[model samples]
Target: MVTKWVLLPVPAQDADSIELDIAERQRKRGEPTSPSAGELSDDELASEMLRRTTFGAFIPWPESALERLAAATTETTRRWSIVMTLCAESPGTLFSTTDISERTELTIGEWRTACRHITPHLRKHYKDAPLWGPGLYEGSTEWPLVTMSGRQLKLRHELHVGITEEQAKRWRAVLNRTTQNVA
Candidate 1:
């Protein structure tokens, strides 16, 4: 009979130090995260105004937005994720429900249902929401952002390079006024 074993080199750190390092890493992982903006409710908006106001513009929302979109569970938010995906491709660009459906692989009806759900949370510069009339395509979604004119779609805090500073300022004023009216 014979027995054999192989030995592998280990770091020289003491057991106590290794244990302390593991505990520190675990504790760091349990640290709390700030509340998500999605947690806010329309009713709680007034009470949470200060917190909400601090929520700055996320135009061209970071790549993390795609992660959020892919993880969306609800119908409305799922649609928002889709629309935002297209818009992100060309910030301040125009797109329709067809574009959205084609891009996201969702049915037109389903896309519309999702679009209706997000209409309220979006900006309404004209008489209606940024989207909802003579969209990029007929009978499709309209611009889903703060807009000053037909082709000037206002992203969170970004404007197309062609737009002048004066126009951007005016758009800001218009958006501010519209936002105030809603509040």
Candidate 2:
């Protein structure tokens, strides 16, 4: 087989033209071509940045949700620790019992105890829906906002979206306040 080579003039694209083409494609796909920060407040800009960091994988929870959870679990040390540890992780992170134990320096038994304590709160928050439902994880019913597969663990979708460094710090502050109150 003989391959024929034909030389043709290539069109040159300037920087601005290339950029316009990209913007046009993005507009067609219904994406914002640029940030309109002038119209957004400081808090709104921060929230928008957080949302972009998720890349559409998950939606971050509102301040009220985090406040509610922190308040709900204040009296439980282990549960509060676990919640803060998990919230410190990136959204959609998958870990394990060993992982949580290592992070919290708490025993597996304590982790189990914490899960038992938190499950009721979670069930109420989720309107009594069975979590880690069929085919996801069959480990235990006591884990709310978390699912286990064999030995691996992950935050349930609703809770996972709320994990962020800032959120984790907020949880830590809550834990500290409770500890101070008790002491």
Candidate 3:
């Protein structure tokens, strides 16, 4: 498993209801409506969300990695929908590109085009450890956050091993519904 993971800026509220629940609790307590609004950094908020929802409190995933996963779930982009679909479907399991394409009901060409859009972003945002080599110009057919080997794609090992079965089902429900909005 690769130890280096991409980091994203902010935590996404869509991945779980914890933030909303917290906000409600605050309301009951007559506290501010925004939970931890300025108190926690983007990385901290992301870590808190993942700890409370997807992974248990003990998973050692770095804050940035957590933010990355949160961002993946929250994005409305076609490329992100592809990633969310793959992760939601397989989690830690390996699935082929063909499998993901069939699941998305996208032709291989469309799938490839979606993947192409992710490369520049990944290359720009994660230059320190380039997620899928340096660039698409190098003939990389891999995704930004997803781990790829030939045609086999899997969620990052941390996500695969860290996310529980029940949590995965929640993620599947959220991701599957969001994926439908891509078209």
Candidate 4:
């Protein structure tokens, strides 16, 4: 007998809650709120929101490689849903080439090349902010772990809610399979 293993990356923290909040807001308000506000004009607000939401956490990657991999891999509906939810919730928290290589058991070089392939698409679609200059974010240059205000918190909450629902679905499926085997 052979055992097959499937490796799925765990959803980031608060993914479900954030998704729920976003969905609810869209339903009730009919307008998505900006992720953050920091005393700026309209243009500045747009730029800042784009920067904060789009690519704050994740490392940049190339486009072609990502496309090939996304095409080749057979992602389940659940996985795709999770990915979409993640992108909506926090587009900035992307995996770097190195991070992807390490997590997915791919070679660093391969991951880097793939990242290069996908990056252009990400840039074009996501419109991430420019890289932070030296001495930003409490003088450490790292992405801030905490959201800046209540609005950001609400968005994050919705993302987590969506993640939770997905997790519950997965867990229930596992339980059902186990029970069927036992019977």
Residue by residue across 1-183, what tens digits does model 2's lDDT show?
222222222356575776687679767877766445554455444534444444232223344454555555454543654555564655434345556666666676676666556656555563333334344443323232333343121222212213444545555666577678879
Q: Number of clashes in model 1? A: 0
Please say which candidate is ahead in lDDT: 1 or 4. 1
TM-scores of the models, in the given order? 0.30, 0.38, 0.34, 0.22
TM-score: model 1 vs. ground truth: 0.30
Q: Write the per-residue lDDT of candidate 3 for residues 17-73, one digit (tens) a residue.
A: 766775687678777755344454666545444433423222232334333543554
Best-to-worst lDDT order? 2, 3, 1, 4
Give per-residue lDDT, candidate 1, residue 10.
39
Q: Which consecutive 10 residues in model 1 have the weakest lDDT in total?
A: 53-62
Which residue runs of candidate 3 sit more than 4 Å off their true CA positions? 1-76, 124-144, 151-183
Candidate 3, poorest ten consecutive residues by summed lDDT: 151-160
Rank ordering of all candidates by TM-score, starting from the highest: 2, 3, 1, 4
Best-matching candidate per TM-score = 2
Q: What do the candidate models score in CA lDDT, each in turn?
A: 0.41, 0.47, 0.44, 0.36
Return whichever of 1 and 3 wins on lDDT.
3
For model 4 the TM-score comes to: 0.22
RMSD in Å for model 4:
18.2
